[model samples]
Target: MTDSVFTRIVRREIPAAIVFEDEQVIAFMDAGQVNPGHVLVATKRQVETVMELAEAEAAHLFAVATRVAKVVQATFQPEGMTLLQTNKPAGWQTVPHVHVHVLPRYANDGAELVWPRKDPPLAELQALAARIVL
Candidate 1:
């Protein structure tokens, strides 16, 4: 696969306002800022999605994200925050690289995450749950 925009940023081929970094993960300011302190935390390894991550790697990624969220909260003082991690295109993932958005939110920021409620019957939900192999 061709290098993603994030890959370039990781390689220093592109400039980014990075917030934190370690051997396993990197946290940086998001270019398309939903708020003043919106940040993106991603793995240093170029994996396309969360499922591609090993259990340890995925754990470390969120750990760093939690730390970054604290920093954003202290600095930006936003009313609320959203830690968004999307998957494929159908899941609102525009970027293929696995990352989590540490977004600072305020009242009526205009960002909407709307979806229809399914509200399946209890028996139907139980049947769906029974199909899972996990």
Candidate 2:
């Protein structure tokens, strides 16, 4: 299996501001931050998307993400928090590696994600869903 940047980071092949790490997961600061204390939590293996992760791996990643989120929340003291994970490129995923983005939100913070609402026909939606079957 080909290794992702996250995998390299986990193996110390690449540098990352690691905040937490375990056998299954690693949490680190995002090199590009959308908000203060933004953290990226990813699995050690080279899973490219959430749909590609095993159930046990998914659970472990979330558990680690929660732990890291707590630290980020405490450090930033934002109004609320947002936990985001993107899948394919169409889902706004820049990296091929699976990762969870922990974003701290503030009351007046201008950070917002806007997507044009498009309600495709039911037939098209069904066809797309069918094609995505693992």
lDDT of 2 by residue, 28-55 (tens): 9889887879999988787788989889
Alpha-carbon RMSD, candidate 2 = 3.4
lDDT of 1 by residue, 38-57 (tens): 99999889888999999999
Q: Which regions of candidate 2 fall more than 4 Å away from where they truly are? A: 117-134
Give the top-scoring candidate (TM-score). 1
Model 1 worst lDDT window (10 residues): 1-10
Mind sharing the TM-score for model 2? 0.81
What's the lDDT for all of these models?
0.94, 0.88
lDDT, candidate 1, at 110: 92
**Candidate 1 local distance difference test against the native:** 0.94
Q: For model 2, what is the error of residue 20's alpha carbon versus the real structure, in angstroms, after optimal superposition?
A: 0.5
